[model samples]
Structures are given as C-alpha cells and as structure tokens.
Target: MTTANLPDLHDLRERTRQFAQARDWEQFHTPKNLAMALSVEVAELAEHFQWLQTGAATELDDGKRTAIRHELADVLLYLVQLADKMQVDLHAAAVEKMALNAIKYPADTVRGDARKYNEY
Candidate 1:
C-alpha cells in the first residue's frame, strides 16, 4: 500500500502478522534473524551512496530518488516489523532511548566535543 494510505502502527503490525502467518514465516522471523535482516537492508540503503560525486548524489532524478526511497522504506518496514514481532513499542522505545542518550551526552558538555558518549 502507498505510505499515504498506510494504516496506523497497530493495524500495520496486524497486517504483517497476518501476512507472516499466511506464509508460515513467523517461525523464521526470530528477533535475531529480523535484526540481521534489518541490518542488511540498512547496508543496502547505504550502498546507494557508495561512490557518487558530491553534486551528482544530491541531483538524483525521480526514478533514482524513488529507488532510494523504496530502499529506505524497506529498511524501515523491516525495523517496525521486527519491533512488532518482539512486542516492543517502536515509537516509545525510540523516544526513551533518545532520552537516555541525551543524558549520556548532554549537549552542553558535548557541544563542540568530538568524543564518544563514553568519553563524554
């Protein structure tokens, strides 16, 4: 379905559940496997920019942009699917994780610093 016509997260999760069940794929979608798949999709997404010239990369035509967008959506879909499979609230988890990161790397302390979080 088009993203503009996409269902809410709960509905999306249910749809994914039904899809997986129909194909008997739920057993194959273990957390570890799903996580690995997500990582692979992310790598593929990154590959789109492997060696493009600075200006050329940003000047992608409609078709190129659409391809990149599809790759990005693939990555995100797998991510959300994984989260749903694990019964984790993706949005809440993201917000909570970012909150923890903020404490771990307070902007004032790390503003101009180039150190890792542990070093900060």
Candidate 2:
C-alpha cells in the first residue's frame, strides 16, 4: 500500500508480518539479532546527542535533523520488525507495561520524581 493508504499501528503491524512472510526473513529475525540491531541503532541515535546541550538538540539544521530522523526511524523500524518477528502484539505489550509501571510508580508518590523505581 502507498504511504497515504498505510494503516494504523495494528494494521501496520499486520502489514509488517505479511512483508516479512513474503521476504522469508522470519528465520533470521531471532530476538537476539533484533535486540542487537536495536541496540546498535540506539547507539547511533545517541551519537547525535552526545555532549550537546539539551536545548540544542531540536535546533538541528534541516540536513542534520533529516539525518537524525533517519537514525530514529531506523530504531523504530527495527522495533516494529522485531515485534513482527516475535509474533508479539506491540500495542498490547506497551499498554500492559505502562499499566504495570503506573502501579510501580504512582503519580501521587512520584510526580516530578526522578529516582529509580526501587527508590520510589
């Protein structure tokens, strides 16, 4: 489907599944490999932020912003691909995890808090 016709998250996930199936990449998309790739992409993203003032980040020029965007997209694409590879429901997993986190860090007790979970 064209970008305009692209579906929402769940639908896109299904499309990702179909794409992987057609390409026969499931066998090579093991969790370990996907995780490694994700880590590498994250490092690439971090490289752009290294030693930069926090406010200076989004101030990137168009070319720099585009480059950073590409790296960010790589990280996201790998994550979605990993979800497809693992046959996991990313949306549900995200919701469930967030719920668990809310319990672990109730806002009344943790609002504006910056401590680790165990500390909280």
- Compared with the true structure, all predictions reach lDDT values of 0.82, 0.81
Q: Give the per-residue lDDT of model 1 (tens digit) for 1-120.
A: 654475577666777778889999999999999999999999987787777775275568787777789999888778888998788998789899999989999998899998998875
Worst 10 residues of 2 by lDDT: 2-11
Q: In candidate 1, residue 8 scores what lDDT?
A: 71
Which candidate gets the maximum TM-score versus the true structure? 2
State the displacement of the C-alpha of residue 110, model 1, in Å, after optimal TM-score superposition.
1.9
Q: Which ten residues in a row have the lowest lDDT in candidate 1?
A: 1-10
> What tens digits encode model 2's per-residue C-alpha lDDT throughout 7-102?
566566666667778999777778899899999999998888777777275667787778789999889877988887778777889999999999
Q: What are the TM-scores, per candidate, against the unseen true structure? A: 0.78, 0.78
Instruction: Give the distance in Å from residue 54's predicted Cα in candidate 1 to where it truly belongs.
Output: 5.2
- Give the clash count for model 1: 0
